[model samples]
Each structure stands twice: as structure tokens, then as C-alpha cells.
Target chain A: MTRIGRRGAGLMAAAGLVAVVGVTVVRPQFSAAEAERPAQVSVDEVEELERAEQILIQRCIERAGFQYMIVPRFVDPVPFTFSYVVDDAGWADKHGYGAALRRRAEAKVDPNERYFRSLPPTRQEALATALNGPEPVGLTATLPGGQVVQHSDKGCQSEAQRELYGDLPTWYASTKVIQNLKGHRFGMVLGDPRYQAALPAWSECMRDRGYRFTSPDAARSEKLTQVVELRQAGAEARCAISTGLGALVRELDTSYDAQLREEHQSLLATRVDLQRRALPKARAL
Target chain B: MRFMKKAVAAGAILVAAMGGAVVSPTSASAAVTAPPPDGHLYAWLDINAGEYYHCRWVGNDDNWTNCTDWDGVARNMHDRASSVQNRGYTKEVNLYNDAGQRGAWRCLSRGEFWPDLRNVRFNRGSSETGYNYPMENRISSHLWVSSC
Candidate 1:
């Protein structure tokens, strides 16, 4: 692949993908909005629930006779949907996987961690109890493969969870599989022949732009110089789109999501009901 | 390795991709299962008696035994329980330290695996606010509650 120059910029703009001006890399609309999908709990929904949890935890801590400061929710420069797959060339061009977000998140929590550490062990235990309940107590389930996990209904932690998702243990089991399935989905995508086939092209696109990274993750490493990092990331993002990795994986994800929904239609129904009930309660926080 | 106070959901067999940069797990067929029977909130005591780990399930039988079951022929071991893992499919269970269900109670939410019973510290006072004390092995009686 020839090094992309003004020709590449003009070509991308002509295709309605991006517009590059000097050092500026333009982005297309986020693809998650490209389709109107069935309603499941969105990342925004989960984030809201989490923020409510933090508030409740803070309150619980205060009730335990210690002052607890609320930490800001860790913000990612990229949308939650985009985090799983760097399928957005525009996002990558502007922010290489938003690696700085990790540091930002850490900085946000440092004070909270410090304050927590300052408490005496007894106070610490009290705070933990107030927040988590009397350690985990509740249900133990065994899966067919000898893998067992437990869910606890104890503590303010569970209380906060219950506020968002009714029927806490059931909700947890149902919603939890969604996360597990997703991890599996990603693994599947990486293994698919088409995605594997496209990687070399993505790597070539990055290489043509003077970056020698073999993968987008490598090009997006935060350790690199900010200027060089963004440049490489931008190049990889454009390449990812040009190679059609974004659209391909998006299709795969949608398909898998549908299959899982069908397989667990019963659980999904409860999940939808719980999340709908939860949204308003979370907002009330 | 740091003590992950957080109970890890039984570890997934992780599949690494792109030279291990992108990591994801193959969906285990076992991740889904039918709900437990007896319909009562189920709680498990995780015991590591020396090198081996043992899990004991309690509170599902018609006459589930606990410290409060004074009329029972046998009492479920109390305080010997090291940690609790709750598998209550739908409801929350409360674990108590004092007999007759009248004392400090801990609510175990559903689908949560807490690796340690000694995880909570509370102050031993007369009311909601008190001095801090650890709650490991002190559970005696418990009741299912509406919420934790």
C-alpha cells in the first residue's frame, strides 16, 4: 500500500469516510448509530446505574461514621461501544484508543483510595460491611461443567444493585451472562477468518504511514509520544475502516447478540423489565 | 499476587488474539444453567480446611438447619463457616450473629460470591452506629429479607 497523502485524503472524503486536512484527521458518524437496534440496556444505562451505586456507597460510608468522598466515574474519550473494537477510524484518528483515560481514571480514584487506607482496620471493616454487607452470603449455583459461582444478597453493595436490577440474584445471573457472552463474542471475532485476513492490510496501512506496529493495540499504546501516538492511531483507524474491519466485526457482534437473545429469550425478558424499572430509580439518585 | 478480596467468578478459559494483545474468552457452555431447587435462598459456606477447599450448601431443605432451629435434631455448624457464597436465584438472605434472629444481620445479595466471611467490620454498639468489629465466623441465625 502506497503511503497515503493528499490523494488518500481526497479519496476518503470522496467515499464519505473521512476528510483529512493537513494534520487534522476527520471522523465519520459513530457506527453504533448506523442501525436502530432492539432495546437492551445501553452503556449509558449501566454507567448511570454505576454512578448511583457510587452515591449509595458514599452514603453508606458516611453512615458508618466516616466521611467518604465520591469519585468521578472514569470517563473514556471513546464511547463504551467503541472501546471493544477500535472500529471507528475517526475515533482512532482523534484519540488512539484513549489510553490516557486509564491514567485519568487512576488519578480520579487516588484520593479515594488514600482516604480509604487512612482508616483504621476496624473502621475499614465497618466501612466494608456498610458497603458490601457481612461479606458475601446468599446463593450458590453449580453449572454443568463443574464451574460454580455464588451471589450474595447481603450488604449495601447488594442494596444498591437491587435498586437498579430487581430480583438481584436472578438479575445478576441473567445480566452477567451477557457480559460473559460478549467476551466470547470478541474472542470469536478475532478467530474468524475474515477478521484475521484483514489484519495484515491494517498492519500494512499503519506501516505505510511510518509506524511498524503489527496490530492496532500496539499502535495505540500510550507509552509513545503523544504526537506520534495520535498520528499512528489515526492512520490505523483509517486503515481499519478502509480494510472494512469495523463493519465486519459490527455485523458479527449484531448477529451474535441476536443469537444470544434468542437463546435466552426468557432471561432477556426479565432483564428488560428490571432495567426499565432501574432507569428511573437510577436517575432519582 | 494480591489477595483479590473480590470473588472471581470461576475463571474463564481466556483466549488471546492478535499475539495476545486482544484477549477474550470462549463462551463456556456451563455459564448458563437451570435455577437451583427448593426455591429458598441458598447460601454456601466455603471452607479451606488445610490444603483442600470444601463448599457446603445450607438453607434449601424444608427444615433447613441453623442456630435458630433449637428444636432441630442437629445444628448446622456456625462460626466454623469461613466464607459465604450466595446462589439465591431470586431472593436475598440475611445471616445473623445472635440466636433467635435478633442481632446484627448481614444481607447477602443474589448471584454474589464473597470469598471471605470476615470481610465486614462493625462497631459493637447498641444501635446502627457503633464501634468496628469483624463479622467472620460469628453468624448464627439468618432470615430471608426483601432487600439487603
Candidate 2:
């Protein structure tokens, strides 16, 4: 109804809300169905332990790409949440010190998920075995309809999960659990009751390479402006930023980059200019 | 990587959300020097006149050009099989669908033509970037020249 600047208005998206009916008209019993729906099926005590170990192993592989265990962190740019995969070893080596980490969630898996408590040590071991070397193994959890959803410990990237489940919450938990365990066990630390023990070891590894580690939560917070600047200055800080609530970053993702290049060619040039100009001026310690 | 491809898909969805015509892939003809008086001479290559009108094409140079009709209203929304500079406005613009058949359409942006010298000289596609590509060829008839 209202207009703003020429192109800016065109680019703008409507934000303010108006009251609207819930989708009850389309799916009348939506809330009821949710209540009646079967909770996520928990695996057998034997299977739970294997899955946990598998999760750790997968994290190790993911961290190998980063040169060591790096935290998968969340980045937001409106519309979606993004997990920025960073190279921990590269950052530590380049910065010659660990960057300050923020606080992280104590539990990787959601407390309310069906299998959180049911994960037995044996199942955790099976998971570890599946993740240690190659090929993805499928684990099935039976749902309410006598239907089973097959989940792979390895083939689960953020995007894949998004496609399969469509619901953001499921994708978030499953992906974080998978990426977290793999990262911890393979490159940085082993999954143990003393898993938190790995934090100090991580600090030492980062310290040896020159990073200053702190709380994982702070590392994922809005305080990244300075760290981003350091990264742009070529420090490549080891981003152990935990995957805080996975949604996708709407604008900063690759899709936006291509669109800017194609539909809005000039903006591509502008972004390049901004990165070039601002990056060099950023201070790196 | 799959992440990058999905990102590209998301970008296209965004373009659809924004309502700007995504550039179609096709070959655009070169600019024709003289636009006939009766026929509307569309400026393809950016010029002072066309730039004044906020008309430009996106996508590969081959397929698309975002332009307005003679009156500065968006009339023909079509792929640039040949750019306006090459072939002046046809009486009836042809539209094509994915099946490559002519399709019915409606023009998107239509307002009274405001032919401003300042607006003409500095026409940037996206306001964020003030990029101006001058239209080389001029309409030989309507001479609004400034005697400096």
C-alpha cells in the first residue's frame, strides 16, 4: 500500500504482521494431529550407544576438512539460518592463537527428542564404527504409522536434512547431533564422559597455533564483528561456533550470490568492492 | 557442491518472490543505428536517452533486455531475440512460453513517462550501485540538444 525509494522499495520485503487465520482451514485437525502423532521413536538401548559413537566419528571426519575439530556455528541473514563451516586448523595456524569461544549448549541433542535418554553405550559404539572410515550406514526408527524413517549418520548435511524433513526443528537436532559427534571424535577429541575435557585440549591446540579460546556461546553470538574482521584480515580464526538453532541464512548463502551476479549484476560488483575495501582495513591480532 | 546449487535454487525463488523478470537465455541482436520515425526505436545498448528512461536488460546479453515502450510505460515484456537497438519496436510484440509459443501477457511497470535529463544521464539499475552505461545512438529526429 505504501511505497519507498525506487529500487530500495522494490528490494524491500513486507515485515509488519496482520492477523490471519491459522492453517486450520486447510488442515483442520492440524493441532490435534500433532498431539496424537507418535513421538520420535527411540532406538533400542543397544542401538542408542552405537548411534552416539557414530555421531562422534562423523564429527571427526567433518573436522578433518577443517584441519581439526571446528565448531559448526549459526549465521543469520534474514529468512534462514546458516551453519558456517570453518577450518579450525587453518584458523589456528594462521592466527597463531585461538579466538575467544562463547558458551555452547551443554547438550548437542535436544532434551525433548525421543532417543536422548535411550541412547545406550552399545548403540553409541555401532555409530562410532559406522563413522570411523567410510560409507554411510542407515539406521531406521519406526514411527506411529508402522512406517520407518531411515537416517544416515554420515549423509546428513544441513541441506540434506532440510530437504528430507521439511520441518526445521527435526533437521536442526539431527544435523547438530551428527556433525557435533563427528567433529569431536575424529579430529579434535574423543567422545568420553570427559568429553568436556577436550575443551582444554582444544584450547591448547588452538593456543599452540595462536588462538585464544573462550566460551562457545559467546563465539556464536553477535560479537563476531571483530572476529570476522580478523578473519578478513587473513587470520582465518578457528570458528568453533556451535550450530545454534539451524535454519538457513536467507541472503548470505550461495543462491543469493548467484542471483546478485545474474539478476543484479551491479550488486555483485558492490559486494566485491565492499569486501575488498573493508577487509584490508580490518585489524587482526 | 550441493550447498551451492541449493543456494542458486533459493536465489531463483527469491527472484520470483521479488517479481523482477529473470533474464531468459537467447541471442539479442545488435543495436540498429537509426530508429524509423513512425516505428519506435528502442535503445538496446545503454545511451543517454535510454538511460534517462531507466531501461536496461539483465541476464546474458543474448536473451533479455528490460525496456519500456515509446511512451515510457512497460509495454512489451519479452526476451531479446534481437535488442531494441537492432530492431525498433514492432507493432505487436511477440511473447513465448517454455514451449516456445506466443503467450498472452500484461506489462508490469507503467507510469507517465518522465523524460528527465538528470535521470537520463545517470540511470543505475539497482540503486545500491550507481552504474551508468550511456546509450550510444540517438534518435535523429527529436533533437533536444543543449548548446553549451
Candidate 3:
């Protein structure tokens, strides 16, 4: 596990400047400069980072005298809906619940899996070891729940992450903590009185539009014909906007996310710092 | 070849089906089941996929409290899995530490098998802070995702 060196600290200071600039231009509410303010990392940047890691993995495995396939990460055709309700009428009209897109995605076979299966037994075993490093024993992380998880620090995969992210242990811990925060944030948003108070209006709006659903999730989960599903989804999205459900959910979700970020500021800072530093390296790859 | 730690002990049971050679517990456990091909994710009651006590699922399951094992007998898999295997065709399998997919979790890539989950751990859960726990015998739910 690599410690955050002086170079890393310098990079973090630069990242802090960027965030401060963002706050100054975007949200004037906080006149004080918050060095730990979270920067919104774009999806494209994340994809680039993933592609870079795959490249590094491919190189590492090949150096170990094994053939490694660089599988491109799957990109969802439909955008993710983070809010409890779907607010984009256009998106709903085009892809109701994105069932068809999901099916299409499922049908798309992964080349990596196919290649691995085609290898002879001995070669397959060797390749697996090369890629994964035999066991999960080198790097350890204690999660927010206090569960200690470990990953192989010797694998080509681990090397690739270390190459880009700097410290594998810190990267693993911070990323896991950030990802798991979603569940709690979702639960908080669901239980919020403001969210609950707005739900009835959204439900009533949908009801008036010939749909009987108490929540957007209920509406989305109901099975219907393609044509009906499209129409219902359109109505749901419209109702979400009309009743202010979508906006409210988004606001609450963001608020909670910010609060969580504050609570785990140091971890978030480290993760964002690493990512920012890796961006140039990812682009170069 | 790096043989799975438990393959030696389970080799006798799998030899007939796997041609007297067991490379990994994934192939060993898979040899026990007939037909339906090998695309389902499996969870075992004992480490190294202990003798005939396992359940398989091809899709997402929110709860495994009363699921049937390989022998067609009813078994509770929730929070009772000591090992796991992902024989999935493409997707990665996510094993959650809590039911209803609400807790700490980890992803097992395609063809990856954990013969002994005692070495694994659920990264963390938002609400349950500061509690160190092993992943062994504590998986409550699962889902197949595109990536880890």
C-alpha cells in the first residue's frame, strides 16, 4: 500500500483550487473556501480511467507470459435515473423503464468471458492466477460497517489500479465507502417528510392520467404492453414534474450526498485527489 | 495449474463427472448438478462447496431465506453461505451481506469462485459503521450486474 506522498499532497492542493473556483462561480452560498468540496466527476472521465486500467492490465498480463484480453467496459444505452421518480418526459417516451435496452445489454456477450472459456484447462488456470493473483490477501480495507475486506495486491489487476490510483488500500476503502453511501442516502430520501408529502401529489397526478400508482417505483415495476408502458412512463415523468416530486427528490438526494461527503471528507478528498491525478495518465493511455 | 484449496478433498465426488481431475471448486461443484448447463451463480453452506449443500440462481434474488438446494431439499441460504461460485456466462455476481440488497456487498467476476469465503469480507454498509465482520456465512442476497 503506497502512502500519500508529497507529490500526492501537491496534486490535492491543485484539486482544491479547482473546487474553490467552482464554488466561487457556481454556488456563492459558501464564501469560505472549502478545500474538501467534492468535484463532480464526469462519466466520460470515469470511462477513460477504466479504459486506461484495462490497458495497463493487458500489458501486465502479457509481461507475465499470458494472453490477456482487454474487455471494454459496458456502457448503458439509457441514462441512470438517480431520483425516486423519472422526470425526463423525453427519456420516458423513448425508453419506458429501459426494459428493452436492458435486454439488449444482457444479450451482448462479453468477449473476455468467451476467450477465457476457450482456453485449455491449464492455460485458463494460469491466466486466472496471473490476472487475479491467487488469493485475496495482500491489501486490506476496513469498511464503514467495520467489515474488513482484502484484495490481492500482487495481481495484474491490482497493479493497474495502483498505477492509476496511487494507493490501492486507500483507493479500495474510499471507493467502497462512497459507493455504499447510496443505499443510506436513498433510505434517508425515502423517509424524509418532504419527499413523502410530495409523493401523494405525484400519485394523484398519475391517477388523473389513468395510472393508479402510489409511487414512481410501483409505476415503473408494473408490467404492461410496449405501447402502454411507453404511455404510462410518459405520464409518470410528466406527473413527476407537475407535482414537483422529481425536483424534490433530486434536491433531497443531493443534500444527503453532500452531508455524507462532509462526514467522510478525508476519504472523499483522497479519492477525488487520486482521480484528478489519474486523469492525465488515463488520457495519455 | 493453481488448484482450488478444497478441490483435493472434493475430488472423489467430482472425479466421475469431471474426468478424475478438479481444477477449481467452481468446476468441482458444477460437476454435481446435471442439465440446465452451467450459467447459474451458486452458494454453498460449507467452505469448498461442502458436500451437496448448495443453491443456485440464474437471476437476481432479493431473499434466500427459504430456497431449495441442489438435492431438491428446502434450505435457508440467507446469511448462511460459506462459499460461492460465479458460473455466469458474462455478468459479475454481487453477493450482499444483507437481505433486500441493502448492505455491504462484494462482486465475484465471471468464473471466479470463492472456495472459502472466510478470507473475504463485505466492504461496508452505510448504517452499520465500525463493525468488523467476515463475509463467510453472511451472504443474504445476490444480483447479476454488468460489472463489479
Best by TM-score: 3
- Give me the overall lDDT of model 3: 0.68
**Residue A128 lDDT in candidate 2:** 27
Say which prediction, candidate 2 or candidate 3, comes out ahead on TM-score: 3
Top-down DockQ ranking: 3, 1, 2
Query: What is candidate 1's lDDT per residue for B73-140, written digit by digit as tens?
Result: 24464544454544432345666555545454455554455343454432121122211234566655
What are the lDDT figures for the candidates, one per model?
Answer: 0.50, 0.27, 0.68
User: Poorest 10 consecutive residues of model 3 chain A by lDDT?
Assistant: A26-35
Winner by lDDT between candidate 2 and candidate 1: 1
Score candidate 1 by DockQ: 0.06
For each candidate in turn, the TM-score is: 0.51, 0.15, 0.65
Residue-wise C-alpha lDDT for candidate 3, range A149-217, written one tens digit per residue: 334566677799899998887786687668667655776787789987887899899889998887776
Tens digits of lDDT, candidate 2, A1-285: 122244235333211111244344534444575456433222342233233333443454355331112233222111112122233434434432223321122124222112312445344233222222111112222221122222223322322223333443344333323322221222121112233443454445445546564322223323245446345323223323322111122222444444323553443333333332322122110
DockQ (0 to 1) for model 2 = 0.01
lDDT of 1 at A173: 67
Retained true contacts (fraction), each candidate = 0.10, 0.00, 0.04
Interface RMSD of each: 17.9, 31.9, 9.6
Which regions in candidate 1 have their CA more than 4 angstroms from the true location?
A1-59, A68-72, A80-90, A110-114, A139-147, A163-166, A212-214, A217-227, A277-285, B1-148
